[model samples]
Target: MTKTQARKLPGYIFLSLTALASVFPLYFMVVSATNTSRDVLNSRLLPGTALFENFSKLVAQQDVASAMWYSSLNAVGTTVLALIVCSIAGYGFEVFHSRGKDRLMAFLLLAMMIPFAATMIPLFQMFADFGLVNSSVAVILPAVATPFLVLLFRQSARSFPHEIVEAARLDGLGELSIFFRIFLPTMRSTLAAAAVITFMTAWNNFLWPKVILVNNSYQTMPMLISNLRAGYVTDYGVLMLAVLLASLPTMVLFLVLQRAFAEGITGAIK
Candidate 1:
């Protein structure tokens, strides 16, 4: 090998090992899903022949389809709403300048410091009072105004060229139109990254969904898989199947938006 190739060999080897390590758990889960409970419990290394049977059992015991649908719907809804709200709020905060606005922005950012658990009880009470409990509204409402997303957008918006805003203003474009026409298209990658993040959070959210969705009819994937545990003997094969199925949306989302996700992170860091 050439000298340069020899020098980079260790780095490549290390990266290959890291990539394999990262993928191993997912590989293991897929393998386990195909196995019976006994085989999975024994940590079988190869794919088994029980894939369809396990999936069938999973469907029989729980509303896997409904859970998938609810989870995907709620996640998508939450993402779209959050992006709209966050982008608007971020653009407004970045563009508008006043002492009062600065104070409000500070307060908005400070609100992010408080853990969600701290506010959960009050939020639950408020939502329950509004008759939104056991509904998608309950989940999406609290998540709609994510301060982190707002802050992320605001920071990213700082990099937006004021020249475009000025030109748009000269052409008599309204604020909303400028944002929709100019800012949205310019920040497509950032928006995609944010959507993926929001979707992942909403999809994988266990505690909030669990607390709100006590009724099996309203439960999502996390709750459904959790519910697999009845009094005493739980179905391992079925649980693995459900888990594999539950993971599909998030995995697909990440795969599709991974480039944007990387760009967004680098842009934010820059």
Candidate 2:
């Protein structure tokens, strides 16, 4: 090989090894899902013939369908609400040019530093008082107005063309009309990124849902996976199968929107 090529070969080799190491756990999990419990405990690295048996056991023991439904509902609901609310807040922060708005945004950003554990108790008490405990609304409401999403949209909105807003206003379009018709459509990439984030967060959320959703009927996929290991005799094969099922939606979503997500995070206008 040439000298330059030889020099770069070590870097390429290191990256390739890192990539393989990152993927190994996922490969192991998928293979374990097809093995028996004993095989999984023994750290079998190859696929086995018990895939159907593990799936059957998982289905028989858990309400997989109901968990999927509730998780989907919560995720979709949270994504839609967060997009609408945070997008509006972001648009206003960037375009309206009002005094103290920056300060307010900073305050909101600061709120992110406060861990969720600190507010969990008060949030629960408030929801319980409103008779919303064990409800999907309780699970979704607290996540809809997150600061990170608002900040993400605000940063994306910074690149939005103000000339379009002024032109639309001169043509007698209302502020709301200008936003929904012009701004929303223009920020599609950021919105897609935000939607993926919100959906995944809502779908995989464990601690908050576990605390608020007291009813077993309203369990989400993460909760279902948790329950699989709650018993005395843990079925590692079935547990891996449940984890695989829980991971599929987010994995598929990321694969589909990955391009948009990247563009959005980097503040691409298109």
Q: Over the stretch 1-270, how does candidate 2's per-residue lDDT look in tens digits? A: 999999999999999999999999999999999999999999999999999999999999999999999999999999999999999999998898676999999899999999999999999999999999999999999999988988888888888888989999999999999999999998899998999999999999999999999988899999999999899999999999999999999999999999999889877433
Model 1 lDDT, full chain set: 0.88
Clashing pairs in 2: none
For each candidate, give its TM-score against the true structure.
Answer: 0.94, 0.97
The residue-by-residue lDDT of candidate 1 on 1-270, one tens digit each, is 999999999999999999999999899899999999999889897999999999888878888889988898789899999999998998888877568877987898899889889999998899889988899988887898888888778778889998889999999999999999999887888898899899999999999998887688988999898889763887677788888999998999999999999888677667
The superposed Cα distance between candidate 1 and the true structure at residue 253, in angstroms, equals 1.2
Q: Which stretches of candidate 1 lie over 4 Å from their true place?
A: 98-103
> Residue pairs in steric clash, candidate 1?
none
lDDT score for candidate 2 against the true structure: 0.93
Q: Give the runs in model 2 whose Cα sits over 4 Å from its true position.
A: 268-270
How many clashes show up per model?
A: 0, 0
- Structural RMSD, model 2: 1.4
